[model samples]
Target: MFSLGNVRVRTKLIGGFIIVSLLIGLVGGLGVISLKNVGKKAEGIYSQNLRVVYILTDMQANLERVRGNMAELIYVKDQAQKDELKKSIANDKEENTNYMSEFESINISDEEKKVYEEFQKNITQYRSLRENVIKLVDEGNFEEAEKQYVPIRKVTEPMFISLDKLININVDSAKSANDNIKAINASSNMIMMALSIIGLILAILLGVILSRDINKPLQKIKMFGEKLANYDLNFDFEVTRKDEFGQTGGSLVIAQNNIKELVKTIIENSQSMSAASEELSATVEEISSKAINIDEAVNTIASNMQEASAETEEIGASIEEVDSSVIVLSQKAMEGSNNSNESKVRAKEVKDSSKKAIEESQIIFNEKKNRMLKAIEDEKVVENIKVMAGTIASIAEQTNLLALNAAIEAARAGEQGKGFAVVAEEVRTLAEQSAEAVKNIQETIEEVQKAFKNSIDTGNDILEFINTDVHKQFTEYEKTGNQYYSDADFVSTMSENIAAMSEEITATVGQVSEAMQNMAQNTQKSSEQAEEIRESVNETTQALEHVALTAQNQAELAQKLNEVIQKFNI
Candidate 1:
C-alpha cells in the first residue's frame, strides 16, 4: 500500500522499544557481576578446607607408623631391633608434630578447629605414654612396658576416631561448597545466554520494523516523483503526520500535487498560446510595415531639405558676387581720385615754370635798355638792374617757403612720401641758387656800366630781339594748360593700396559664404536625423507592447494552474 510520507510509524516505535530493552539488559548483566564478591570468598574457604584435610591425613599416617614400630619393638628380643624401632619412632613423632601444627594454623569452622584440637591432645598423650613404655623396655622391664602400651592404645583409638570425624566433616563441607560454586556458574551462563538470545531477537525485529517505516514513506515519495517526471497531471498524494520526517513527507505531497496541477494548466495554456502567438507575430509584421512607411516619409523630407540647402547655397553665392563687384568699383573710384590730385600738383609746377620764363624775358629787355644807356654812362640803367635783382631775390624766398610747406606735407605721409620730400628739398636748393645768380647778375651789371659803356648799343639791339620773341611765346601759355598731366608715382602708390584692400575684402567675403553654406547644410541634416529618431522610437514602443502582451499571457497561465491545483484535496 502507498503511504503519503517517506516512512511508516509502527516500525519506528518497535525498533525504539527494542533498543531501550537491550540497553537495560546490558546494564543488568553488569550489575550482577559487580556484586559477586561473596562467591569468591566461598571458593577461598573450600580451597583452604581441602588443604587442611590433606595435612590432617598426613599426620594420621605418621602416627600409625609410630604405632607399628612400637609393636615391632615388642616382638624383637635383639638390642639392634629395639634401637632401630626407637629411632623410627623419633622420626615419626617429629613429622607428626609438624603436620598437626600446620593443620591447626588453617582457617576452618570453629567446631572443626575444636575437634582438631581434641584429636591433637589425644595424640600427644598417646605418644608420651608410648615413650615411657620404650624407656621401661630399654631398662629391661618388659612386663612394665606391656602394661604401658594398654593405656596408649586407649588414647590412640579415640584420637584416630576424632581425626576421622574431622576429615569427614571437612569433606562434606567442601563438597557442599563446590556444588554451590558450580550452581552459580551455571546460573550466570544461563543468564548471559538468555539475554544474548533476547537481544538478538529484538535487534532482528527492530531492523525489520525500522526498514519498513523508512522504506514505506520513501517508496511513496519515489513513486510520486516518478509520476511527476513523466508529466502525469491527474495524480494526488497526502501526508497526515506531525514529525520532522512527516512534515517533509507532507511538503513533498503538496509539491507533487502542485506540480500535477501546473502540468495540466501548462498543457491547456500551450494550446491557447499557440493561437495568440500567431496573432502577435502577424501584428508585429504589420507594425514593421508601418515603420517602413514612416522611414520612407523621413527619406522624402530629407531629400526636400537637401534641395532647400542647395538653393540657399546658390543665393549666398550670388550675394558674394555682388560684394566682389562693389569692392572692385570702390578700388577704381579711389584710383581716379588719386590721379586727379597728382594732375593738380603737376599743373601747378608747369604754371610756375611758364611764369619764370616770362619774368626772365622781361629781365633781358631791361638789361639791353640799361646797356644802351650805359654807353653814355646812364645811372638809371644801373638802378633798374639793382631793382630786378631784389625782385628775383623776393621770388626765390617765396618759392623756398612753398617748398618747405610741401616738405611738411610729405613728412606727414611717412614712408609713402619719401620721394616727394626729396623733390621738395631739391626745389628749395634751386630757389637758393637762383637768389645767388640774381645777386651775381646785379654785380656784373654794375661793372659793365663802368667799363663797357660804348659796347652797350650792340647789346641793346640783341636784347630787344630776345625780349620780343620770349614775350610773344610766353603770352600764348596758360597756368592751367598742363593741369591734365598726372604724377605717375603717386597714382602707382594709390593702386597698390587699393589692391591690398581688395584682397582683404575678397578673403573675408569668401569666409562668410563658406560659413553660411555650412550652417544651412547642418540644419538640414539635423532635421532629417530627428525624423529618423522619431521613427525609431515609434518602432521601439510597438516592440515593448508585444513583449508586455507575452508577459501577461505567462502570468495568466500561472494563475490558471493555481486554480486547477485547488481541485485536489492534497
Candidate 2:
C-alpha cells in the first residue's frame, strides 16, 4: 500500500511510459477503426440507396410533366395556339425519350424494364396523338385536337403509374439502407463502449502493476533505513540489476559496513579508555600507598625531631638548675673560706662534701650521655624502614609486570581488549612511580641512619670524658687548704658546665611527640584517598563490561542481516 512516488524514479518512469503507450494506442487505434466504419456506412448509403432514390424521383417528375402537356393539348382551340401546344408536347416527348434511355441503363428486373417500356410506349402513343392533333390544329380542326388529347391522357396515365411504382421501390430501398446504417451505428456504438471498457480495465491493471512495482521495494527500503538509523543493521535489501535502485542498495550496504567499522572502532576506543582508567586508578592507589609510607617516615622523623627538641629544652632547664646549684655551692665555698679559723676541720669536711657533690654531678652527666646513646640506637629503626621501602618497590615491580601481561592479552583480543591495554599502560606508569618513591624513601632512611650514628659517636666521647673527670674529682677532694681555693673554683666551674649539658637534653624530647601526632594525621588522609581510587576502578570495570556486551550484540545482528540478504539472492 505504499505510494508509487516513493519508489525509485526509474521504475516509475518505465511504468509510466508503458501506460502512456497503451492508452495512446488503444484510443488512437480504436478511433481510426470507428472512423473507417463510418466511412464505409456513408459509401454504402450513397452508392446503392441514394442513387436509386434520385433516379426514381426523376422518373416521377417526367411522368407528371407528360400528363400536364397532354391536358394542355386537349384545351388548345386556335390553330396558332394549338401549334404552340403541339411544339411544347413534342419537346416533352423528347425529354421522356431521354429519361427512358437512362432508365434502361440502370438495368432493373425484366418486369420492371417491361413496365418502363410500356410507360415509354404510352408516352410514344401520346406523342403521336399530340402530333396528329397539332397537325389538325394547324388546319383549324378543333374536334380532332380534343380526340388526340383523350388518347394522350390515356397513354400518360400508365406512365404516372409506372413512375409511382418505381418511386415506391426506391423509397423501400432507401428505408432499407437507412436501417442498415442504424444497424452499423449500433454495432459501432457497441464496439466503442467495449473499447472504452477495455481501455479502462487496462489502465486500472497497469496502475496496479506500476504501483506495486514502484512502491513495494521503496517501502521495504524505507523501513530498513529507519532500522539502520536506530543502529539496527540486521535488515537486507534485495534489489537486483544495475538500476538506480540497485545502486542505492549498494550504497546502503557500504553504509552498513562503515557503521560496523565505526562500532568496532568505538569498542576499541572504549576498551582503551577503560584500560587507561584502570591504570590511573592503580597509579592513584600506588601514590596513596606511597603517601602513607612517606607519612610514616615523616612521623618517625618528626618523633626524632621532637625528642631532640625536648632534649634541648631539658638542657636549658638543667642549665638553670645547675646555675642555682652553682650559686649555692659558691655560697657554701665562700662561707667556708670566711669561717676557716673558726673550724678548720669542719671547713675541710665541707670542702670534701663539695667535691663529692661535684663528682655526683659528673656521674649524672655520664648517665645523661647513656640516654643519648640509647636514643641514637634508633638507627636500626631507620634501617628497618629502608627494608620496608625495598619490599614496596618489589611489589610495585610485580604490578608493572602484571600490567604488561594484561596489555599483551588485550592486544591479542583485538578491539575488544583495547581499553584494557590503555589501562595497563597507566598501571605501568604508576608502578614506575611507586618504584621511584621506594628509592627516595630508601635514600631518606639512609641519611637518617647516618645522622643518628654520628650523634651516638659524639655522645660516647663526651660520656667517657665526664666519667674520667668524676673519678679524678673524687680522688683530689682531701688535698688541703693551699689547693682548696683552686679546687673549690674548679669544682664550682664543673658544676656549672654539668647543669648546661643537662638543660639541652630535656628540651629535645618534647619536640619529638608533636611531630608524631602530625605524621598520624597525614597517614589517615592517604588511606582515604586510596579508598576513593578503588571505587573509581570499580566503575571503570563496569563500563568495560557493558562495551563488550554491546560489541557482541552488534556482531550477532550483522550475522542476521547477512542471512536475510542471502534469502533475497542479491
Candidate 3:
C-alpha cells in the first residue's frame, strides 16, 4: 500500500543501496553462521562422539594384550621371569581400568550405558579369573593355572561383544554429527538463495516504481515545455504528486493559464484596433468631400471671431479672477501631491518591512528544512535505529538457532533432557519475542520517517504560499500608493496648463478671422491629401487582412497544441 510517488528520488537511491547492503550482510552472516555450526559439529565429534569410540577401541586392544600376558605366565618356571610376566599383566590391567573410568564419565545414551554395564561385568569376571591363574602359577600348580586360563579366555567372548556394541554406538553418533553438519550447510545455502532472491525482487520493484514516478512526470513536463515554446498555454498539467516534478508541473500550469489570459487580452486589443481602423476608413471619405466646401464656413467663422474679440475684453477681467482661483487650486493640488508623496514613501517602507519579514521567515524555514534533510541524509538517529534493529534481528536469529540446537541435544539425553528442553523452549520464545520487537521497531521508524517527511512538505507549502501570494499583494499595495501620487501630480500640472491657456485664448481672439482665412487655404490643400489618404486606406485594409490571416493560423496552431497537451495527465 505504500507509494513511491511522494518519496524523494534521493531517498529512493539511498534506500536501494541500503537494501543491497543488507542483502549482502545477511548472506555473509548466513555463511558465517553455517561455518560456525560446522565447526561446532567437528568439535563435538572430537570431544565426545569420536573420543568415546577411540577409548572403547583402545580398551579392546588392551584386553587382547592381557590374554597374551596370561599365556606367558603359565609356561615360565623361573621366579624372576614369572614376576616380570605378572608385572606386565598388572600394567595392562591398570590401563584398562583408566580407560573404563574415562568412558563412564561421558554423557552417553541409555542404550549405550546398558551395553557398557554388561562389558564392565564381563571384564570384572575376566580380571578375577586371570588373578586366580596367576596365583596357581606362582605356587607351581601348572595344571590348575592352565585350567583357569581356559576359563579366562572363555569369559572374554561376551566382553568383546559388549565392546563392539559400545564402539558402534559412538560410531553411529559420529555419523549423525556429520549428517547434522551437512544439513546445516545445505539449509544455509537454500535459505541464503531464497532470501537473496526476495531481496533482489524487492529492490527491483522499488527501482521500477521510482523510475515510473520520475519518468512519468518528467515526460509530462518535457512535453509541456515543448508546447509552451510554441506559445501553447492550454495544456492540462494535472500532476499531483508531492515530489519535485509535481511542484514544477503545477507551476507550469499556473504560468500557462496566466499566459493564456495575456494572449487573449492581446487578441481583444487587436480586434479593437481592427474596428478603429474600419471607422477611420469611413470618416476619411466624408472629410474628402468636406474639404471642397471650406469657403462657405469661413464667413461664419469670421463673424464668430468678431463676437469673440468683443467678449475677449470681458473675458480678460474674468480670466484675472479665474487665475487667482486657479492659483489657489494649484496650491491645494501641490499640497495633495506632497501628501501623496509622503504616503507613497510610507507605503514603500511598509512594503520593504513586510518583504524583509517574509524573506527572513523563508530563510529560517529553509534553514530548518536543510538541517532536517541533512540529518536524514547523514544518517544521524536513523542510522542508530537501523543498526539497533539489525543487531536485534541478528541476535534473535542466533538465539533461535542456539535454542533449537539445545533442544536437539536435550532430546538426545532422554529423560535427563526434559528440563533442558523446557529451558530451550523458553529461550526460543524470548528470541521470537525479540524478533517481533525488532520488526515493530522498524515499522515504527518507517512511520516516523513518513511523519517527518510530511512535516517538511507542509513547511514548504507554507513558505511557497507566502512568497508567491503574500509577496504579490504587498507589491500591489505599493503600486497603489505610486498611482495615487502620480494622479495628484497630474492634477497640479493640469490646473497650471488651463490657466496659461485662458490668457493665450484672450490674445488669439483678435487673430481668429485671419487664422480661419489661412485654414480655408489649408483646407483646399487637404483636398489633394484626401485622395492620397484614400489610397493609403486601401493599403491599410490589405495589411489588416494579412494580420487576420496570421491570427487565424496562430489560433489553429494553439488548438493543435492544446489537443496534444490535453492527452497528458501531467
Name the top lDDT candidate. 3
Q: lDDT scores for all predictions? A: 0.73, 0.65, 0.75
For model 2, the stretches where C-alpha displacement exceeds 4 angstroms are: 1-31, 39-59, 94-126, 139-151, 238-247, 262-570
TM-score of candidate 1 versus the correct structure, residues matched by position: 0.42
lDDT at 461, model 3 = 81
Residue-pair clashes per candidate: 6, 38, 0
Which segments of model 3 are wrong by more than 4 Å?
1-3, 10-34, 78-80, 225-236, 252-570
TM-score per candidate, chains pooled: 0.42, 0.40, 0.42
Clashing pairs in 1: 5-217, 6-217, 6-218, 7-217, 8-213, 375-453
Candidate 1 residue runs with Cα over 4 Å from true position: 1-42, 74-84, 137-140, 185-212, 257-570
| Candidate 3 C-alpha lDDT tens digits along 407-450 | 99999999999999999999999999999999999888878778
How many Å off is the CA of 365 in candidate 1?
99
- Candidate that beats the other on TM-score, 1 or 2, i.e. the better one: 1
